[model samples]
Target: MTERIYTAGLVVIGDEILSGRTHDKNIAQVASWLQVQGIRLSEVRVVPDVIERIVEAVNALREGYDYLFTTGGIGPTHDDITVDAVAEALGVPVVVHPQARAILEKYYADKPGGLTEARLRMARVPEGAELIPNRMSGAPGIKLGNIHLMAGVPHITAGMLDALTGTLEGGAPLLSETVGCWTPESEVADILRQVEQAHAKCQIGSYPFFREGRVGANFVVRSTDEGDLKSCVDSLCDGLATAGFDFTPGGI
Candidate 1:
């Protein structure tokens, strides 16, 4: 039987990201997590804190992928309108989740300001949503159907991802092998293309880098099947050897 392929989309919602005030790290982190979950992050959209833009991105991505994850605009601040926008996109009402409220109440009980309205905003979600616990902070992540709402903070998002590790159903995890060479990528461009074409199931990505006044590249071979990945890597290595290029197994 042919193996299933699971895909996901990400919507990065924040004005800070677009303004270059806060560098977006969630994309790389989420993509890596999805890879371990056997889901490919097929698409990504970065939008500002505008509700209409968020709603448009949410609606578009949710319908196109098996899973959709949004990071940012879910905090207590006024700009944190991810939940409201997502609810609008899904045609649902935003409601305060009692369990989330209870969590916040308890978390802030010992603090100076106890469960103020601002903090209470974190408890709100789409009418039919579940909570993804955030061990790092009081605010919990939101989950509605295939849409996962997470924090923009890298550490908080990491905690949310940890909570969601085994809950998602995915296909075979993608496996990768890297080969590095101290030669310009253009020198072996044809070889890379030919090797990838011969292995229909494998993909070859060449990432070139300049370091210490020299040019080098790392060729990453990826496939869901271990055999296909290994075969592709071996073929590329053999081709590099025949071409009289010294290569490194891991990366340059």
Candidate 2:
């Protein structure tokens, strides 16, 4: 029997991202972080700040994957409404989290414009939710069921992810080995297909590139089992060699 694979979906909620004013960086960072946690980032959706859209996306993603995460629209501004939207989607009432409020009060106690109403807005969350630590800022991330609500700032998201490391139950982290060669992907497509078909536990991705006026491709083979990954990689290398192609071990 095969081990169960854990998966996660991410929802990016922000008008800025949709408008192209702020380049979204959380998807890549979160995907990388989830892999380290032994969970696969299976799908991602970007929705605008509109509450209806957020609610729709939140409900869809939360239901489709084992875990769901959202970033953006959790700030103090009037337009920030992720908390409210998520609450609606979860069929829960929104309330002020005492701990989150306390964290904010302490965080802004010494700063100017201390704990204003706008800033206090960060403390709101869906009832029955827990807080994810955010040491960078006083406002903590929200966690309700399998839905994780994090900040939009890349660095802040990184900190939140750091706090979550080793906390969620997941499978083994995926491992990959890359083979870089100057052969055109189309030329070696048959070999790639055959090798992948032989390895039931591995997947091969072909990335074609043109640099220095030459065509080349890198094949990445991924699997959770190290022995299976190694066997698949060795077979692929042997196949390439048999076809008279030189390849790099890691990648170009």
Worst 10 residues of 1 by lDDT: 14-23
Give the per-residue lDDT of model 2 (tens digit) for 163-240: 999999899999999999998999899999999999999999999999999999999999999999999999999999
Per-model CA lDDT versus the true structure: 0.96, 0.94
Model 1 whole-model lDDT (C-alpha atoms): 0.96
| Per-prediction TM-score to the true structure, in the order listed | 0.99, 0.97
Q: What tens-digit string does per-residue lDDT give for candidate 1 at 171-247?
A: 99999999999999999999999999999999999999999999999999999999989999999999999989999
Clashing pairs in 2: none
- Runs in model 2 with CA error above 4 Å? none
